[model samples]
Each structure stands twice: as structure tokens, then as C-alpha cells.
Target: MNRFEYADNKFSEIEMMIAIPSFIIGVGILSLPQALASATTAMDGVFSILIAGGIVTFITWAIAKFAASFPDTTFISYASLIVSKPVAILLTFLFAIVFFSITAYQVRKIADISKQYLFDQTPVEVISLTFFLVIIYAVSGSRVGIIRLNMMFFPFILFIAIIVVIFNLNWFKFSNFLPVFQSNINDYLTGVNKSLFSFGGFGILWFYMAYVNKPNKAPKMAALGTGFPIALYALIFLACIGVYGESVTASMLYPTVELAKMVEIPGGILERFESIFFVIWIMAIFNTTAMAFDITVLAINLVFHHIPKIKIIFLLSPLIYAIAMYPQNLIEVSAFETFLNYAVFYYSIFVLVLLFVVAKIRGVKPSE
Candidate 1:
């Protein structure tokens, strides 16, 4: 089999739009509401959502524009073509480490949440390892297979998640959303800045655009991908804020899960709706972990001429597992998330700067 057999020029522009955002938005959606609540009051959460989503949308467009400037060349390839080989290699390494670390962190969070809420008796290591294995298997398939897998799972997850939200509508208190505009404008801006981390996955399009059949329209497709998540996240954020007071939502680690707990079907067929929600969430998290792992693998393959003899998935899995196992408690996990925000912020800067330098040196004009 070819080393990168999945790297086909087969995906339509709409699929590109769907697959890219679906991959990025999965895990991020779970924590975004709490992140906003902590940063500002419940009412201000709306503004935060809008500002963060808007900023992420702009950045996605910029990256898409950069990618489209060089048709048929991946970001790894174009970095070398535009900049010094050494610098390109350095950037590629940075990209790899970023994605790898993100994969580790997300896996760790999933394991932690599962142990806390679902399987109290099962060892955390076992739970996490099993989850990681499933992701590796999914990612090892062809790109088309992965895309189809995402299409199959995304709607079900969304449906379950929305049902949970809708069921909790009666619990929503307008009083919970009182004192609108009570928070300072600066507080809302800071919330927006922090919330940007929730949208970090949109950057994956940088690598994906090269393989798209209609490379010329990749920017528009990418924008569509970015928009989908923004809309979905904003709705969820509003729901969480509307249902629970700002203080209560801010205090909770995963407000979405809390929202799930509040869900009540008329028949009471399920006493614990959160458990059912967890099943769907596991699939969503698996999709994200697989996408992150696949992108990292592709970047490495592009940078190095020699494909290593070892199974790339097997080799990387243990390293990611080890990283996931590092955080001993939720405090440590929160610290790591803070570090991730800074890391992603710098990485975004790196992309923008790298593209600017490349365009200046290559005399490439901005896309028309």
C-alpha cells in the first residue's frame, strides 16, 4: 500500500467544508460554554461567542487564502519553496509538536472525564488506552474512509446533543441571565480571547486544502467549515448560559455535561441521560483525536523523504498515551489548557508571519 494512499484529490468543496469543521469542533464544544462563563457574566457570554467566532473565522480565511495561493502544494512543501529550507523544517516540526500535544491533551481530558463520570471502577489508564486505540484504528484507514466516518457520526452526535439542550429549556431561568452588560467591556474581550482556544481546530485546513480536488475554491470551502462550528458553538453557549446562572456555569468544569444531567424525557426511560450523552461524545472525541493524529502523520511524511519502517500509528500512540497520562488531577489539566492557549496563539502568529514572509519573498499577490 502507498504510504499516503489516502491523499487523493477526490473531496468535493462541500465535503471539505463539512469534514474540516466537524473534525475540529467536536471536542472543543464540550468545554467552550464554561470557558466563556468563567471569563464573563452569562449575558456577556453571547458577546464573547460572537467575538471569538468572528476572530477565528477571519484567521481561517487568512490561512485558506495563503493555502490557495499555491495550488497543489501542501503547507509543508510550500514553506520550503518560499522560505529557507532550515526554517521550513523548523516550522514543520513546530506544527507536528502542536498537533501531537493537542491530541495528547484531548485524550487525557476524555480519560479524566470518563473516570470521573462513567466508569468509576475501571482504571483511568485502561479507559484512556482503549480510547486511544480506537482513534488510532480509525485514523489508520484511508482519508475517504475517515471522511465518510465523520459524515456518519456528526449528525447523530449533533442530534443527541441538541435534544439534551432542548429538554433542559424548562430549567432555563431568565433570572440566570440577569444584569446584562454588567460586566466591563474589557472582561468580555478577555473572554473572547480565551474562547478563541475553542476554535483552534479550524487550522487543520492548512494541510487538508492541498488534497482537495477543487483547490481553486478551497478558500470558500474553508470559510464554510469555519462558519459551521461558529454557529454551532454559539448556539450551545447561549443554551448553557440561558439554562444555568453565570456563577453556577462558571463553577462547573464541563457545563455541557451538566446541561445533559438536567435533561429529562417524559417517560423517564433513562434515569441517567448523561450516560447516553457520553456514548455520543465518545465518538465525537474519537473523531477529533483521529483527525489530529492523521494531520501530524501527514506532515511528517511530507517533510521527510524516507518513511520510517515502524508502523507510524503504533509508534506515535504510545508517545501520546504517555503524554495523556502526565496530568495527575484536574488542576494540572487546567494548567495544561492554559499552556495550550498560549501555544496555539503563538502557532497562529507563526502561520500568519510565515505566510507574510513567504509572500513577500516569493512576490506572490494576495488571492483575487
Candidate 2:
């Protein structure tokens, strides 16, 4: 068998479909309304999401095509094939750091949200540690297990989103979305940049595409995976704008969660809908963090080659925890998240373009 080809039958294309959207719809959703509102006014924010999502879709397609051409080998492996080992190692290692930083962002953001909304009495460290422990357990298992978890939790996440939008319709005002494109060119650019982070999770495609059972259809599946989130995000952003108005949405901390709080069932049985929303939303975060955590370990193993994955998982947990705890307040967390958003956006484009150019120059091709 070729070094890059494996007969592992763990993940089907359907699971690939499940996994990508799960990663895309994570902690970012909570703040998307604010991010959008801050960038532009009214429905212009919705347009920003659509534009950003389209750009990310193209990026996903490029990554999918690149990965499928190299079958069963991740960026870490094939990058080394296309480029020199030292350069590949450096680039792949930087990608690993990007993924790890994402995991840490999720860890801290979820903990802060949970403490503010769910467990006010509990220490944030305790909450974050508990979440990290769950993530560690999930990633420590087979990669297929993480995909299965995504498949299981995605429906609840989707259902809650629909419910929030449905219940909040009473507050919707058509006038709120008026004056689209009123923002200056710079403002639209700012909004697009803000919206870019929401789509960053698609970068996982570079690593996960290697596991697809059918490589030929992988690009289509990858496109589908990314396309759905674009639609879903547009719907949620529109719902938030029509309900909250741009100014109010911008002022709010977590506009989507606030949208949930605005919901009222006819019977009033569910008092704290945002709390319920948070619970399901955490599953999305878990899917993202677990996969990224797994990829981080995979990248390290590619470099070290001899270290056991389990030991690497154990070793990296503390570093993740430390990073998770590093943000002392919401201000610091916001600053850290802003820096990461730019890093993810720029690095994804940089690495993809570099690998594609190098692969072409070197006439890199898969084994027959």
C-alpha cells in the first residue's frame, strides 16, 4: 500500500457532511450579531455575512481540491511531500498553533459565557477545567468518535436556532433592516473582516479531508458542509437584525443569546430559553474544540513521529488549560479573540496559496 493511502473505514462521506457544519457553527454564533452590527448598519450586516461566506466557500473548495489530490495524507504529510521537510514542518507547525489557539479561544469563551449565564457561583477555572476534561475525553478516542458526537448533537443545535427565530418573530420589525449599504466602503470592509472569523472553522477541512472514504466526492461534500452554515448564519443574522435593530444589536453582548432570552412560549414553560440554548450551543463548541484538539495532536505526531498520541494529548492538556486561563477578563478575551480572527483568516489563505503553487511547480501527484 502507498504511504498516503489507508484502508481505514471509520468515516463515511455522510459523517464528513455532519462534521464540517458542526465545526462551523460554534461559539462564534453567539457574538455574530454584535460583530455584524459593529461593522455595518441594518441588513448590510447580512450582506457582509453572505460575502464573507462566499469567499470562505472558495477557500474551502481550494483546500478540498488540494487535499483530495493527495489522498489520505493531511496538510502535515502532503505539505512535506510538496515542499521541503523543514519548510513543511514550519508551515504545518504554524497551522497547528492556529488550531490550538482556536481550541483555547473556545475554552475560555465558553467558560466565560457559562459563568455569566449558567453557573454564576462556580469559579471560571473550575468550569473551564470541566469543559477541557470533556474535550480531552472526546479527542482521546478515535477520530470517528468525534464525528459521531457531531452527528448526534448537530440536530439539537439546529432545532434550538429555529426555535429562537420562531419565537422572536413577534419582535421583528421590517423597518429595522432599512437603508442597506448605507455604511461607507471602509465600514463594509470592516464588517466583512468581522464576519470572516465565523467562517474560520472550515480550515479544519485541510486536516479532516484526508479521512474521507471517497476522495473524489470529498470536494462536493466539503462544499455542502460549508454552504449550509452560510445559509444558517444568514438566517440567524437576519432574525437578530429584524428583532433587535442594528444599534441595539451592536450594544448587546451576545445578540443571539439575547434573542433566545426574548423568546416566550405560549405556555411559558421554558423560562430561561437562553440557558437551554447555551447547553446545546456548547455541543457545537465541543465538536469544534475536540476536532481541533485532535488535529493539534496529529500535527505534533507528524513532527515527532515517535511520541504516543495519548502521551501527547496528556502533555498538551495543561498548555491548553493555561492558555484558556490566560485571559483575565472579557476585555482581554475580546482582544485575544480579535487577534486570532485575523490570524485564522490570513494564515488560511497564505498556506493554501503556498501549497498549491509549490505542488504545481514540483509536479506533485498521488501514487496510483
Candidate 3:
């Protein structure tokens, strides 16, 4: 691909497939096992994980098909058709807030995790500011460039994750998962709600689906993209419990990183395996942060057609950093996450459902 092609388009289904999981496997997975572990009994979290994954995967497919119905159309263009221009613009602005909030949440969470595992001396404010600046730089360029970065970084992230799970095999204790299917309705429901939020980023397809060249191919590819992260999450969740019983997994802040610390190579050449893991892990989180912020900028640019993307980046940079640093402590950060998750979780379902309902009411359907 030449520079023009790279800059102007990435309408391939394959690219969309790669982009979904690359964006979804950010800071959420680090704390997933801990969150799930706390919500259920032995091995019961798997049910929630699978149930939530299935739900997200199906919705991803439905959403892609919805967007693919209107070929070569941007989200706002079709939204304006279904709803009036004013309502669509208002929805776009609201979406900008949601994606911007995602950027802030990822920044803050990554900063907090890095302080605990990678940078003890560094202040979280410094870490968050630096991370957001890097994201700002990435978003300043082409959107295709951000997708290309995901393609490059995804392999290392997946490789490191698989290695971590594999090496921790010896620590696996089947007894840890023995008391299966014992949880009550309420326990399973709580786990389902949390896991559903963990699988949140597939909503990116609402915008990106408009880019797929082969509309017919998008729904399946979207489903495949979401499936990869679901499988990864389940494997890591099981591995964490197997290594540390549910009690221990729930007690720690980041059980996945703790799992990394237990990994040792044959030669002991690099004593700190987690340090390497940390480096690769940042790449994954960067993919998530960069994409969310880039889309935020894109949404704003869509509304303010006169303003260049660079200016939008500069304008939103401070606001992003301010939100990231607003959480004074981990408790506050958790509170912020809970708020953002619900906002994202319900907002995603709401948009898709609203589109479907209004479309049906008005007798609008996907073009053949």
C-alpha cells in the first residue's frame, strides 16, 4: 500500500477483525480475574465470562450488519436519515463524550497499574500526562495509522499473554475450580454484569463498521474479532484461579500481573520476566487509548467540519488529562470506573436498540 492508500482508507473486513480485540484488551483484562473472582464461587466466573462473551459477540455481529446496510456511509450520515439532523448531531456529541471518557478511564487505569508494578517512584500524574501526550501525538496523524499500529502491536501482546498463561500451568490446581455451579442467581447475575462491562470496547464498531468494503463480510469478522478477546479473557481467568484460589485472586489488586511475576524461563537470563511483560503490555493499552481518543477527535471533527484534526487534538488534550488526574486515589478511580462502565455499557445497548426500534417504527431497513 502506498502512502495515499494507507492514509485515505482501511475498508477491509480483515482490518476491522484485527482492530476489535486489539482495542478491547486494554487495562480491563489486568483486573478481570480479580473482579470476577470476587463475584462468584470456584469456577462459577467461567459461566459469567462465557455468558457475557456470547452476548457481546452476538451484539457485535448485529451492530456490524446494521452499519453495513448503508454502504459507504458515515455513522452521522445514516443516523441523520433515521433521525433528524439535529437529533443525530446531538447523539454524535454525546458519543464524543463517551469515547473521551473511555480515553480518560484507560489513561488513569494504566497509570495506576504502572505505578504498582512498573514505576513505583513515578507519580501517577506524570505517568498519565506522558501517556496522554503520546496518545495525542498518535491521534494527530491518520486514523489508518492508528489501525496499522494495532496490527503491529497485537502480536506481541497476544504472545506475551499466551506465554504468561502457559508458563503458569504448573501452578494450576484443579481443586481451585472444584466447587463448580454452586453460586446463586444473584451471584451469577453480578458476575455477568461485571464481565459484560469488561467486554465493552466492541462498540467501536458503530463507527468503524461504516468503513468495511465488503458489507456482507463485516458481521462475521466482527464476531470473530470479539471472540478472540473472549477466549483470551476466559483462559486468563481460569489460569488465575488455578494459580491462586478465588480467595487469593480476589484479594490482590491485579492478579494477571501477579501471574506474570511467577513466570520463570529455563536460563534465568532475565530475572524480571514481568518487566518484559510490562513493556509489551503497554503496547496493548496504548492501542486501546489511542483508538478511543482518535475516535473522540474524529467525532468532534465530524461536528466541527471547519476545524482541522490537529486543532481538535490540541483542544481536547487538556480535558483528557484533567479527567485522568481527577481520581485522587485508587478508591476514587474504582468509583470512576464503575460510573464509566455503566455509562458505556448501557449507552452501547441503548444506541443499538434505539436504532433498531426507530428503524422498524419508520419502516427503514438495510438496503440490499
In order, candidate lDDTs are 0.78, 0.85, 0.88
What is the TM-score of each predicted model, taking all chains together?
0.93, 0.95, 0.96
Clash list (residue pairs), candidate 1: none
Give me candidate 1's TM-score against the actual structure. 0.93
lDDT of 1 at 228: 71
TM-score, cand. 3 vs. native = 0.96
lDDT for 151 (candidate 2): 88
**Candidate no. 2 TM-score:** 0.95
Question: How would you encode candidate 2's per-residue C-alpha lDDT over 1-368 as one tens digit per residue?
Answer: 22223246457877887788898888888898898898887889888888888888888877888788888876777888888789989987887898899889899998998888889899999999999999998787777778878889988888988989988899999999998779888888887887788888667777788888787787777778888788888899999899988899999898888898998777878777787888888888888889889888878887888999889999989999999899889999999998988898889888888988888898987766
- Each prediction's RMSD over C-alphas, in Å, is 2.6, 3.5, 1.9
What value of lDDT does candidate 3 attain over all alpha carbons?
Answer: 0.88
- Model 1 residue runs over 4 Å out of place are 1-9, 308-310, 364-368
Candidate 3 residue-wise lDDT, 258-314, digit = tens: 999999876887668999899999999999999999889878877888998889899
Candidate 2, residue 82: Cα displacement in angstroms equals: 1.2
